[model samples]
Target: MNPARFLLPLSLLAAVACSSDASKKDPVAEARFENEKRIGDENITEKQERDATFVVDVASDGQLEVELGRLAQQQSTTPAVKDFGQRMATQHAEISQALGVLAEQKGIVLPAGLGAEQQKTRQELAALTGAAFDKKYLELMVDDHANDVDAFDDMSEDAYDGDIRGFAAKYLPRLKEHLELAKQVQDQVEAAK
Candidate 1:
């Protein structure tokens, strides 16, 4: 006989029922579920779908571009500087090719050209020649390799993919060697003037 009490209980009951039924599949959720199922059935893993190329790729591309740019600048440099440039070009090309193979294996696409960091370094290298060119290039090489060694070390320790980790570990020594060579080159350039 008390109308308000009866209406309040009924409203509470309706609210509870609505909340309980909220898990019933909505159109959006159903579509999402269907899409996920399709993707799973097609055997697409996260590694395959993701572009996980990291710092090594960036370093490789940048060094390659910068070395090529130096060779192209037609600076009146000595044979030793030219030889260093040639070595950088060769080493970076091999590294880039290695990255390309990994990218292909992982079904991830990468840029055909250099990464932005590499492009920037190359532009900087392009502005100088002779002693200036040598100093800048050596400094860039040392700084870049330092950054790369840290990145590769971090990735080697933390990468989820076995192949990526292996690649990082394998490349670490070579990168360290490059850093040493760069330091020597820097000292030689600095001592020359």
Candidate 2:
């Protein structure tokens, strides 16, 4: 056997092994590897990003219901719920308008009604009265606001479009304030009953 042929084969194997190890060391590749582990076959893609935005829009609409329900349920009875509902109605309406404009501009259409979770909440709130209504309403407000804030924060951080990021940035503060108000109202409701 020729020494040159033997040397070439060994060098080729070494090069292949080294390249494989180098590919493993790359951070972008590593991060992608991690993502693959977490998301499995449901990979994040541009189409998925667009579809995911509808979920966000639906959430915005749901927040409107949560706020409006609080207003409608309590305005006749509870002053604080009325006040907070007014704020919710105003802020959520504005967010809805902004999202509408963005949706038009982006050519995305949101689903017509609140998803099942929001509808269930709406029905649950509708069925209660007085103190029970106030407690359940305040609990929903707090939970909804927390979720709103987090969703917006994540969108701001990782959204695929300028419109989505802008929407998230514009709404996050309002969501935080809503959460705080919800907490205060919960405390007041607790003390009152």
Candidate 3:
């Protein structure tokens, strides 16, 4: 290529670059910038943000519950505990999936596994078997469900997102039912031991 031919195009390109308005914003960049600037819009208030955190914590617990319940369903000698485990595993897996989708839609980030306390609880359970496992698992179930029922009941009424509120509302009674089942199984395990 001729040196003059290359030099002419380079000069023209530089001239064109210098001619455009530097202040003119790119549409995609503008939208992205606006989105970042508008982080947590009016629809997502501090209360809603707190609710989102609640949703994520619940999701994390849900995943742990499902995993633990799956183990129980496999290992429990007690038929009632096994049945309860199966129910918890099935119901909680579904809830986790729903919460995952909702969190994505709402631009909330949820951790993939159990939180520290739940992880510790899971580790403790993993070290046990037979009656010990049955008793501990049932006890945990009762405690977890009692807490979950209250949390869901409160969220059902107070959550800013209608879907989240409806979700909590739909599941509050289910959690209560699970709590009742857990209590019954705890009684059985206690009597047997």
Best by lDDT: 3
Local accuracy by lDDT, each model: 0.69, 0.72, 0.86
TM accuracy, model 1 = 0.66
Q: Give the alpha carbon lDDT tens digit for every residue of 1-193 in model 2.
A: 7899999989999999999987768889889998887786455565456545644664556565545555554532678777777777776766777777777777776666567766776777777777777787788778877877887888776776766777788778877887898899889989987
Q: Give the per-residue lDDT digits (tens) of candidate 3, residues 1-193.
A: 6899999999999877877656467889999988876775744677787788888878988988898898898778888888888999999988888888888988889997777888898888888887889988988898888999989989999898888898889888888988998998899888887
**Residue 38 in candidate 3, Cα distance off native in Å:** 15
The digit string of per-residue lDDT tens for model 1 on 1-193 reads: 8999999999999998899799667989899999989888665455333227573465455556456535634662755566666666677677767767876786656666666776776677777778777777677678878977887787777666778778778888887887787788777767777
Q: Which pairs in model 2 have colliding backbones?
A: none
In angstroms, the error of model 2 at 66 is 5.5
Q: Show pairs that collide, candidate 1.
A: 62-118
Q: TM-scores across all candidates? A: 0.66, 0.68, 0.74
Worst 10 residues of 2 by lDDT: 67-76
| Residue pairs with clashing backbones, model 3 | none
Q: Assess the local accuracy of residue 17 in candidate 3 as a C-alpha lDDT between 0 and 100.
A: 81
Residue-level error in angstroms, candidate 2, position 141:
0.6
**lDDT score, candidate 2:** 0.72
